[model samples]
Target chain A: MGEILVKEKEIVAPGDVLASGMDYIPTDGAFRDGENIVSSLLGLVYIKGRLIKVLPLNGVYIPKKDDVVIGRVSDMTYSSWFVDVGYAYDAVLSLKDASSDYIERGADLTTYFNIDDFIIAKVLKVNKSMAIDLTMKGPGLRKITRGTVITITPQKVPRVVGKMGSMVSLIKENTGCQIVAGQNGRIWINGTVPDMERLAVKAIKFIEQNAHKSGLTEMVKTMLSKEAKK
Target chain B: MSYNKRFDGRKFTETRPMKAKTGVVKNAVGSAMFQIGKTRAIAAVYGPRELHPKHLQDPSSGRLRCHYNMMAFSGSGDRVRPGPSRRSKEISYVTELALSPVLDLSAFPKTVVDVFIELVQTDAGTRCAGICAASMALADAGLKMKDLVCAVSVGLVGGTPVVDLNYEEEAYEEGAVDIPIAMTPRDGKFSLLQLDGDLSKEDFEKALALAKDACQKIYEVQKNALKERYVEDKK
Candidate 1:
């Protein structure tokens, strides 16, 4: 029988033997070498049934289809707009995907979306060369003009959003700030009181710094309350 | 007379004390510092982001570029030039070769992972120290790799095999042969091997065995350093 070598939630480095034998399956950041499952990244080990994978604590975001991302328009072509979505290559936003209204050919593209303007976009496709296609025609997808954008490590986004977005909802309910968190780690915060916006940003950063720790939800709530009082 | 006693009072199989730490540079995606005796090297990892110069990017796999530099006052010899010298350039090229075997950049096509290694102090084994630090930094950066690489210099000090030679022993008038070796400990594969002096085939084999053992010890230090980056935070 195959034997698992590492404990659940144990931190593993690259080349660390996670399991030995063919009975176990490896996925994600873990791979099979001969009969042994070896971790290919420095991260924590997670085992479910016979499937073992390592979840990374840090890394750049690779865009995926259907992921809602916050991007800034870097340039415009005659037919499409190039959005910088924190990837190696710029994502293309074609005119048809930009809006529901019919835009005439060669019409002023800047009037619809200009350079340096941020928008909430959805990834439509990613080709073999990592070329990305983005669309802004979706619910909650539009130009962002009235909020301050802040970024955290992409790996911490899941934690900042929390389980079913409980963490973000808590922050919103308490601080009365409108917050939108993109899977790419960019967050837009808009609030009536500048102080509350600042507090929400601080709470998000605190969640990022302590993302790996347990009891993080309580800690974030405590921090938000203390900071709001000042 | 043949060289017998080590000047520093270390055994033939003993290496100088080693110290290693990860995440030294706050701005870098990954960074580390490694010190072996008087030699110290710091490395920072960036990119796998975007590769500039449209022509150089490869569609199938990412590129690895290493820059090896010694601070102007870091050398025991005369002051180092501020810019890249021929020796530094060669070392940089070899450093890349030493690290590429374990690194898997297939997931990040058309990009580059840049490693910057700076020597803040020097004695001997600067390249080996640099390789160790760079390996840790790459791992800390969350890059996928087959295994970590460990390196050490093994040599014959006048017919006696030594695990890691210090600067004084390298300059021993009686004659010493320094052979720097880098290995992927798990696979027992050699990624780097360079000879600076001569030795008998028999002595070379013996020293190679010692070097392999020494590398295992260095590997332990590297593993501990990486784990400490997270483990220490638990306290």
Candidate 2:
């Protein structure tokens, strides 16, 4: 029982060669059998007649519970404010849950978080009700006043963050950027200057491409030091 | 008639057969029945337990799994071609995306909550129906959440924002366009938006406004269904 190789968005009209190497259908969906395939690894599935294929799950922000994500205050209500972390749901930072500090009656929580003010928080839960609650009570949860936030595959966030936060820590040490990791697969990399931001982005992307391998700390430290020199 | 109406003799913006039921499954931790007109979707929730394969187990933040499916005969004239279609798979993806913000996966480690959504009949807006049903199902499953998420698609036909479109209205070749939005009305935040086609930013804003209005009504329906289920459970 061998695997098959199906192309990405291959146009197979009629008796076209949908796959090669193996006669059997791939158990995984991104690539499929001659027919009747599902992109099992989270993506958009498109079908024509009986044949189906997939477009890989793109974008950096896929949703997950307890993912410490970063976002901006898009809108506010009496009870909660909508934090647009670029996931399907705008994370709700409720009045009671936003912080440890007591919010008095009629005290505009807006002072704490105004529209477009960036922030970092942890996802508490996603109910069948689809309500996303957030709390700023984690080691990295806080307000991101300024800098840059780059989106990457939520699946690759671990790689971007590196083992035990080594990769992120190095970037902070070298570039002086504050980074926040969201569980839903979003990262807020805030560097003081454009160059630092660029360096941070480059480092994150490096982790993304080579996340499967080991010894990423030395690799990232070397990469950032080299970029800083240039 | 001062204004024209649809096939069901309802105003363009008027919703159809909006009914909601809950507790359809006893085994499920939570469950809900959500319908927009004739389209019906059943959602159920389970877990907060060890996600096996074991290696994926994290000490912090439990895993979340979601499935959006349609019954074989969910459509009027067509037998639903099963086994995770792309549309349904995307539904599963967005369904997961729409809820992660509220799930609090960090509090529970090594546990996973699985949400399953099945459409018994689909006219239009099945994804939104599944999302709405799934949210209620989580509640029935006894999962804690900040609040409910209500999703609805408002299309623009004749440049007007029509709340909740049926299959015919959706497939119609002529007329204006529409957009789908998932939101939590209690807070003015959007969950999911599968808006395609073309529209000025203005039309897009109006569609969002219409979706917000529709979600408010949907929020009440979602609460009532959960309340009824809990009330019945006691009985």
Best by lDDT: 1
Q: Write the per-residue lDDT of candidate 2 for residues B13-44, one digit (tens) a residue.
A: 56776788876876665677898889899887
| Prediction RMSDs, each to the true structure | 1.4, 20.8
Candidate 1 CAPRI level: medium
Error of 1 at A104 (Å): 2.1
Q: Model 1: per-residue lDDT, tens digit, B53-88?
A: 978899999999999999999988899888899999
The CA-based lDDT of model 2 is what? 0.68
Chain B alone, candidate 2, TM-score of: 0.91
Colliding pairs, model 1? none
Q: What is the C-alpha lDDT of each candidate?
A: 0.91, 0.68
Error of 1 at A57 (Å): 1.2
Candidate DockQ values, in order, are: 0.76, 0.01
lDDT of 2 by residue, A1-230 (tens): 33233444332111122344343343323344234232322222344443444332222244468777778899999878899875434778887777778778888777888898888888887664345778777786788877777766565676666679776787788888777776555677776688888888888878765553457678787887788788
